[model samples]
Target chain A: MPENMTHVPYYPGCTLKSKALGYERSAMDCARSLGFEMHEIEKWNCCGASFPLTKDNLMGLTAPTNILIETEQHCKERDIDAKLITLCSFCYNTLKRTDFAFREEPGKLKTLNEFLNREYKGNVTVIHYLEYLRDVIGFDNLSKMVKTDLSHLRVAPYYGCLLLKPQKELGLDDPEEPVILHDFLDALGCQVIDFPGQVDCCGAYLIMRNPDKVLELSHNILEEASEYGAQTIVTACPLCQSNLDQSEAVRGEMPILYFTQLLAVALGLETEQHQFESHCIDPKSLISSCKKFKEFSDAK
Target chain B: MQINTENNQAAIRDLEIATGETISDCYQCGKCTAGCPASMDPSPSLLIHLLKLGLFTKAVNSASIWDCMACLTCSERCPKNVSPAAIIEGLKRIHLNNMEPEINLNSLGQEFLAHSTQQAVVSGFRKFV
Candidate 1:
């Protein structure tokens, strides 16, 4: 994972391209440093999030299937070897899992293919940046590249629900506790907080369908993280980051951030890369709380 | 997940059916209600049960949803998936669509919406996607 690599497919979800633009910038920096190029999935659409269990089940799967087929075809059409990577948590789950399910479930894939053929057509392998870092790139190799150490601050690694629960179905991580986020944080030289509700749901989909549930779920997390002495919360996906940071009930009060925000700090990127002020939660104080560094040279 | 939710502060049948779910089968189980950590105040499970049962009309309109963290802890622990959390979510959806004009939007809500837009543009999952 060096600084110069060939181009690979990238899927920039809504937040990355806009609100989470900071994530996009850090990703670009990381991708380049890791010898990777992000080739965005042009003309991509939603991934059945916000409301996956729509009035029709097949209709729900169609959203993600379209992107998968497009990626699949692109791989075959151009005969390229690289796969698609996502910065969004929900998008990553939908894309990676859809490709996984379709590849493993022939019947479901066939049905999806019929719909895909009518719309988008391509071959693609979907994955979150965290997955590529751990499974393929290796954290040990990743840690070697870090010039800045975040070992002073303790971070509560929040997985939310999509990555964990209904474990037998999603296959994202262990139902009880998932440590991929912590592993990455630990590599960055940060202290990881072992909290009880790390993998719990942040009332993601339920937010739109039920705001009270979202509030209850959110405030609960902030209290727990604060109680556990986690100065800030780091996440790989944007939705959880946004939810943990933006919601009014939990916003302004708790310290939370995206995993990339922390990584950007590690890469020696400017503070703007983390966009602390613009965040709904106003993590400016938390960012400073990450362990005041007069300069990276001071640590040396 | 089941608990003695009876003889509580609120009655289940007194509220409106926001999520369109039936709470009579709830069996006084406080799983969903207990798992919720929305408010620092003691507006616990049984009250949420009553809220779901059409007891608390102002619950959805109030600042409760804004206080909820969207954690699905109760839903996972419920024996019958009584899903007071789900019911609360339904109420929140209704409240958001018709929230008070002076309401202060939380960072999490804004972030979730922005993130949802991104996911939608990427895969056509939610809006226009």
Candidate 2:
């Protein structure tokens, strides 16, 4: 490892360790290829999964606050910038919003710190991997690092809801019209398809209580992407990927991929890192076809 | 509509203090309802209207609050910056605080629990349970 390699704290939340292992694997590989290292934070807990909606419900804020304090400590130990990166959009939203809450109200921060018996100076910056790629690595530079020609693949970039919403808090992109995912696919040389349901919610936690509603909602996103001629749909949220991938309505019609998996493929990383078996819709056939097409063109 | 001025004032005060959002700021522009992806009956605007009219019980007990995905599109699109999503969430908090949680975790099928993502289960518990 280069001495100057940028080392940033990473929080994988719960899904990444279990259901979304591919997301973490591919993201780590991509970060390395892009000249950065994502060191997982020590003993990090879940970011409470959801931000507390009511002002009085400080209990929900505890888990994320503890994680933020841990990230700050990790940054100090590594002597790196006080920045924490997350691959899951849900974690990104919760952590960022929690940090925002603390910044907005010092009293809440003080209360949380006191409760946790830890100190967070409101110094750590929470960022999603997509934002790190765009702002830090620059898509132009990422374009230069692509090892495979993925232009044959027509891809739809799914933003989902948590990644960009409550604009005043997340502020990652225009919640109405986001371009980060589109720009990311462009950098990878894939033909990006702009679809209607790109930024819509995939029924999220409602999946547990109402799978039918999730299917209907996810089906709409898949149908729209397919209508626009997309071969695959890539998303940043594990829950979004799972909801869309497992929907009985569009089960095998669209291959739902984590954005980092596509990035790993384009970077020419090992195929095993993608962990395609976890995906409900097998993306292997689609990826292999693209690979064959690239070989033919290269041989010519 | 029986105008219960006393009940209305208390409900409005409780909501405002809990959510830090002014329900009266909503002007029924319908932008929030237009962008909502979930099947919010009485719609986002009408829910706020119910609250504004001091029909707190009607707003809280409506099945629409449970149907909300909390996508925040309604909150983002609100022209008055009322954050209807937060208000709806406040209603959910109130509902949960007052009543026994409608969705029991043990009652959920084992297959569903096994297949679902952790975030879904965690957030489901946070919101519904």
Candidate 3:
């Protein structure tokens, strides 16, 4: 638990802190296991995700700007150099695109700077934890460091739209179907399946005005998942997990689990610390079959 | 400006608005929810979860909307024919409208520019779809 060992800034967006608590925990453990430390950016606000309801680009730009300023101030105060590691897919996409906007168009960055009245120094690199996991920490190293390998389970790697959508910023894989999740799952020794609904949305934000609609989309993904022979769906995004797991409560029975939940089990982590059952989706039947691997108790 | 919940919800009825039929078929079974991956979120369980909490606003303006693969997995499994994927698409459109054309390394926008690939013959999927 060294606080100064090649520390990076970990930005656990709203979902990570609340709904996706499992993701945050696994991410922290994963980072530490890799011998790295993450200092959270102080008092961060929402990234004006999706959109600000104004239908304007500038408003959208402003959301990330708020975050950028906050991150900059933190960096300045600490006098430490580290790129920002984002846990949420949406957050990663937002920060990466914002940073790219600044770098690609310095003039726009300057205009933005005038609004802030501070010098726009290239302070931090906003990167997705997956990228950090793969690039900053090598795949071979990750494979070697795995205290738990989910070699027995069959998983469908759901990319969801945000992560793989804007292909360029995501740059993780193919536009129609990506392989990053599949690769990560494979690294964990889970038998990854190529499914049809691989790139679909989890009906996340839509849970508000349209429960019926969420049902339709979610049902579609699950039906296809069954067709694909996926016993469980694994996602890196907490929102994705929320839509995939919780959506079933209103609907019926679909087996959806977070990637971290399985990873935690594989890592021999205690169920109480990870709390796999707290998820709206029941992982019982899915992990019940996992008995062949190791002893799993639902203490949480 | 009037919040006509019934009419608005009815308008987007039966998953597909163009159908214009009230999908009176729904029995309120959790079948659709059970089959969905996006339903992994809490709000997806109860349509009310979206409204009661402030989650609805975030959903429409969410990167999560764009995250939908539109595999129709939920639609296919729904006993009531909910088509949560379509609603997600509708919300995603809202996000897309407000979306800044992130010309960064992750944008898939450029993929639509050409109708042709290496040995190719095709327009952007948006046009054909």
Provide the clash count, candidate 2. Answer: 0
TM-score attained by chain A of model 2: 0.95
DockQ of each: 0.14, 0.79, 0.03
Question: How would you order the candidates by DockQ, starting with the best?
Answer: 2, 1, 3
Candidate 3 lDDT tens digits, A1-300? 445567677777666665567677876766676678777888687774542211123445666777777787787787876478887767776777777667776776787778767655666677777777778776666666555546777788887766654454447657565766777777777788888887776565544334466667777777788787777888776666766665566655666766666665655554455556667766766665554233323432
* Least well predicted 10-residue stretch by lDDT in candidate 3 chain A: A50-59
- Candidate 2 lDDT over residue span A1-300, tens digit each: 346768878999999999999999899988887889889999899888888877778998999988988988888887888999998888999999999998999999999888888898999899999999999999999998787879889999999999998778988899879999999999999999999889989999988778889999988888888889998999999999999998833555678999999998887777686699778778888877655235544755
Worst 10 residues of 1 chain B by lDDT: B120-129
All models, RMSD in angstroms: 8.4, 2.8, 15.2
Name model 3 segments beyond 4 Å from true: A1-4, A51-56, A76-79, A250-254, A288-300, B1-129
Give DockQ: model 2: 0.79
Q: For model 1, what TM-score does chain A reach?
A: 0.85
Q: Tens-digit lDDT track for model 1 on A1-300?
A: 555576677877556767778778877777677677787766677565543321123555787777765676656666787488887777776666566555565676677668656533334666678877888778998787676657777888988765554344456567566878888888888889989878766656444445565566667777788889887887766666656665633444665777877776776556665567766667676565454345655765
TM-score of each: 0.68, 0.95, 0.65
What is the Cα-based lDDT of residue B116 in candidate 3? 14
**Better structure of 2 and 3 per lDDT:** 2
C-alpha lDDT of all candidate models, in order: 0.61, 0.86, 0.59
